[model samples]
Target chain A: MKKISTPYHHGNLRQALLEIAVKLIRERGADALTIREVARRAGVTHTAPYRHFKDKASLLAAVAREGFEMMVKETKDQFSRTTQDALARLKVCGIAYIEFAIHNPARYRVMFGTGRPHGKNSALRKASEASFGLLLECIKECQKEGTVRPGEPMEMALAAWSIVHGFSMLFIDNQIREKGLFAADRESMMDVVVDHLYAGFKPN
Target chain B: MKKISTPYHHGNLRQALLEIAVKLIRERGADALTIREVARRAGVTHTAPYRHFKDKASLLAAVAREGFEMMVKETKDQFSRTTQDALARLKVCGIAYIEFAIHNPARYRVMFGTGRPHGKNSALRKASEASFGLLLECIKECQKEGTVRPGEPMEMALAAWSIVHGFSMLFIDNQIREKGLFAADRESMMDVVVDHLYAGFKPN
Candidate 1:
């Protein structure tokens, strides 16, 4: 392996710091991650991170933006490869969302961590909107398929988001005890959750 | 009220410390909480809390236990008041759970913040199980009503847990932007989530 020499001009200093910071966050929980530590691990001066991120919060926002975009892509890809039925594709999206969170728990936390975004940082917000848009599109397809009720897709969209987001959060937070939950049990639960979501919608 | 100043020989120093610690946690965030601070607030020696709580983790577990017990009562009470069928009552339980978290954000965080139980104390674990048992009872009712699918109720239990828990977590973390979500909107979202939950369970 070629040695990437240690130099101040590492071409992609912002990316470097963010990458190391994420690794640190994973190894040590998000609350323990620090700017000084990220700089130290990235072989840059503590102050060097300032050039890329004004503060840890903004750096975290950037990490969230990246995570959101990745999730958006993964969700869309999962939907595209699934069966033609909108209901099935939507289930795939839920599964994919959970899978993404499981795959990148650190990024998941960064994306939805303690603070809310302040302003029109449309790049980050757009990624979030795009991921949500995928779910909305799938719900629309459900309406078209006559499987989901046509009125107020927003209700369905919010419902889907809450359940998927809820499932992932439980898993990430380790609230789901595997001792009580079987390997095969998860699929059945998902079935009940996704399948049961149609109960209240009055179809058009 | 006689200001008998909780003397050095006061009855139940342990309970006193826990009470004051919870108060501090409610007022400020967890990071600002310390055993010494708690002891000081309790008007006791810094070593006093150690006699009752082995460490900070033990104290946190104690706090979480209090929160969990509150949830169990709230859930049971929510079901108790409603004259609706089993499923409708279960929805009330879900709302109560979210309400508990929303109203007591700090306590809710301590209950679900860590991946694992910080203390080896069985009391906290029991309290947690007891609260979950409420949900289990609700799921069993759903099963009886033939509203939930035939399978282990644990998954559905977890899914229900996740939707409300995830929503509460986001709302507590303030990730749900004020721009799009109002208090009324949250109620509507909850309605959709609980309704679809029944949909997910019923026969196709």
Candidate 2:
């Protein structure tokens, strides 16, 4: 392997490596991706990336954190649109979440489902909380407006979140097959899952 | 690397490799696993596995199918101890499923979370269905006994499966954080998750 020395200018090598790393990971499963391959693909010396990331795990964390930051941004963008009521905002948020997963399945999966230990990454942790915080606020709004059933606000948020997140996972994984796959009825099924959560929380 | 062309006279190289693969994957993340690594670890020639599996994907499929079979067996075993009531049986199965995950988080993650397709392996697909079939049957029993709400059996099953499976995923992923680093009151949380599912499906 010919080693190309690092360029005189860093010229965004860290971001460049992160981009290539994710692309390689998305095309091939993580098992097949490595820092050497990423460096090779990025036209940098293998050691060049080491300065930015001590190891592959650090690079993975960087990618995951970036993905999470984007998730927070996605939520904020959805919340920017005005809705007549809390229930409507809740629905849009749900749609937005699923849409985000569908668009960036691999990145989103790596962000949440990769089973990596991210406890050390405070910014990443805060980013995840920020997204969930939006959901919590919406749930509170729905509860106050009498559209959502009253419960511990956190409980309501977690429960509703489990439904939407679980559904999104199932949909992305295509786990719903042999009867769960309805005809072009994505919105209908989303409504049903959301409504199930709604029914459980509805003012009784 | 010296190629040990000596093939085993008896016993199962494939099975041996799989057993090693599972434990190694669990201890370290899946990214480090490889056919050559398994081969070297198992003391078999690199070519020895080719006789058993066409490639890494086939070996992984074998591993996944084994995981699903284990899932089915454990679920059935859980239901065998107690009186056979639909809801009760289902709850036990859920517990068993979570136990399998906690006990075998790596295998469980690969079983469902891996993005690689399980491919055109009928046995693998059938085993996956067989594992899920146990849940569907229990849900039907609930309906028959008038405990389950009126709805499509599969839809209900999907909901219940999502709730428990999602809970299990969160638990297995160790994503649930307890305040103050206290031991998580997982039993209470799991109970509530299932309780919500049961409540959502009670006959109106």
Interface RMSD of each: 3.1, 2.5
In angstroms, give how far residue A31 of model 2 lies from its true place: 3.8
Docking level for model 2: acceptable
Q: lDDT per prediction?
A: 0.75, 0.74
lDDT of 1 at B103: 89
DockQ of each: 0.40, 0.32
**In candidate 2, which residue pairs get closer than 3 Å at backbone N, Cα or C atoms, i.e. clash?**
A149-A201
CAPRI quality level assigned to candidate 1 from its DockQ score: acceptable
The CA root-mean-square deviation of candidate 2, after full C-alpha superposition on the true structure, stands at 5.7
State the lDDT of candidate 1 residue by residue for A1-204, as single tens digits.
654564458667888888888898889888688999999988878899999887877888888898998998887777668757887887787788888987898888777654444355667777887887888888898888887777666657777777778877666765565325646555665655554444444353
Whose TM-score is greatest here? 2
Error (Å) of candidate 1 at residue B202 is 4.1
